[model samples]
Target: MTLNRRNFLGAGAAVAASLSAPMVLGAGKPRVVVIGGGAGGATAARYIAKGSKGAIDVTLVEPSRTYYTCFFSNLYIGGFRELSSIAHSYGKLASDYGINVVHDWAIGIDRDAKTVSLAGGAKLPYDRLVLSPGIDFVDGAVPGWDVSSQNKMPHAYKAGSQTELLKAQVEAMPEGGTFAMVAPPNPFRCPPGPYERVSMIAHVLKEKNPTAKIIVADPKPKFSKMGLFQEGWANHYDGMIDWIGQDFGGDVVEVNADEMTVSIDGEVTKVDACNVIPAMKAGKICEMASITEGNWAPVIGHTMQSRIDENIHVLGDACAQGDMPKSGFSANSQAKVAAMAIRGALTGSKVFPAKFSNTCWSLIDTDDGVKVGATYEATDEKIAKVDGFISQTGESGDLRKQTFEESVGWYAGITSDMFG
Candidate 1:
């Protein structure tokens, strides 16, 4: 079957009409169903199908045909990249890897029956299910703000239309206007994301509207690479960035979207633009599956398999995998391990012990970047970080530039690793 966007949708509709019960395994090739098609899901689908060598049937379910990554999205906001540069197509995963790419929403999972119900009414049976639905905002986490108020104060965390919307809003800011940011709490998708976003916005304002102000009301006292980011902001964007930590009313923030105002410790400040990143939890499908222990699915680290159901493996930001930060690199790393284990279980392939690694890089300005990374090995309990390195606060200009270049190369490499 030729798998293009239009053809795939037509075939999916036909399949949905016929699908009734779960296909029993052990009668034919083992089937694998992957939900969500970003870093974790896309990479897991590609690797499992490729490694299984036609021994396992792979079906990847995602709603969008094109995916935009959240990793380098700050660069897009910083005016360092174009929207097309961050967007990726799933055509290769379907045509090149012999995987069934179904563009539809996965509504529910019947774990006991080993079948997944789709929004399109299809039931896909799987010997093993890979759920990487990513993060969803926690309801009521931000007062006076909800998805409906997103147009007024964008989150831009999902890195597609919201990202574009935020960018356009930032560009449209009036001269010398105030831009406010309400960052998330702990255990969000990326540890450095909010700070990196602040830097990117500072970069844009520095060039476009130098007199404008950027106010950050953060719930946390400190953030990832705090020293480096603080240093960079001091050196590069002094007097323009006002960061309010938890100690100074940053933790107690309320927003009036209708009035375009933010209240920090009851001191209301009117702003021209706002970006609110609320607390997040595992995507809704995780709850639908009844596999989630709390907000996140608990997974056995060695194999990325659900501690609740061995037949299912949860990867990326949606899983509570110890010591692994929720980032694109961590998700892609976890995907390979899950892929290998699934192949071994289904196709009788050799599976090695899981090893994971991640490096989070943030660009402070043009050719100014810093990074923190670690290599990890799975223990009996969790994935534990082994050796790690972080960019020094007083690093040389040359070294910082080199780090930025490395991040550029990494963005190219990891996106290819995920999509292709």
Candidate 2:
């Protein structure tokens, strides 16, 4: 599906090529520029590239040469999966799917010009733009955890860079040291992520240093996959995890970096390592495009199109689509819906109602895991959940295991659809 640089005839030059070769030539294909080649952006590019069959010019803009997924990042701490194992490249998306992959950062979006400005001073114009740049940090949300002091205690939410930073801190810890985790407030990416991360680190501690301990300062009393996670921690992990719920002085009021002390309810505590999962907001690109509301972008749930501007689409963690958690699986699923909607909007074809799904898997022990899932249908006012899509509280052992396997299958299917 690829064409070489020398053969990339200008947009106006396409008429001659189309006149010579009717079936295989692209004359006036609608241009689509996607920012952020993570799960949502990559999936959107692949789907649009293949579905349009040379009828759409697709260009993906991302700064990273390779993407390390947030999924299974805990495995890195547990010594199960290396950072390289989860790193994804966009070569296939460019070569196999006919997408023009630009390794650059998108600095600004010119809504009036219908173009994206790159840091290299290049401007890419598009008939339609699909933005899926994911989330970014909101400064001052957590005092003392902003740009500078984060070097001392890193929030590994974005994966890649943060993953390495957190890993180094853990590796350099003194023997039998204490590791403290400060989880974000509700409705953050991967609801059970911090808990699972601590679990994995605890797993490493149990094996390497028995005297080591893990402290959890959770903002919420209950978490995703709560029952299974607590049971596993108590039964198999020797109850090594010390959890302080929101009511029990677990809410972090402030942090002093030099002292390495976190104040919870004005009570200070010291730690050998600290992981503070800060609050999140939509990527700044969305805000630049004037599509975000508060922490996320408001999109028509049925089409994944922006409520403010119909020509632009937003998905993944950046979007505030209801009933679906900010997750990789959800992003991949929404990409297909957004792709179809964009294709239809371009070709004057039928646009079907969108259906969204997401399931997050958390591995408690080496052999045990749990999951939570949901499906939703969009309405005029908002997206509503379809019945029977969440993890059951009273399900049996075999049922939970089935759900665990389902998450693996989903990751495979979604990535295949994205880069295959």
Give candidate 2's root-mean-square deviation (CA, Å): 4.4
Which one wins on lDDT?
1
Model 2 residue 175 distance off true place after TM-score fit, in angstroms: 2.6
Model 2, 352-375: lDDT tens digits are 878877777887666456777788
Overall lDDT per candidate, in order of appearance:
0.91, 0.80
Sliding window of 10 residues with minimal summed lDDT for model 1: 1-10
Q: Candidate 1, which segments miss by more than 4 Å at Cα? A: 1-26
TM-score between candidate 2 and the true structure: 0.90
Cα error, residue 194 of model 1, in Å, equals: 0.7
Clashes of each: 0, 0
Q: What lDDT score is found at residue 229 in candidate 2?
A: 73
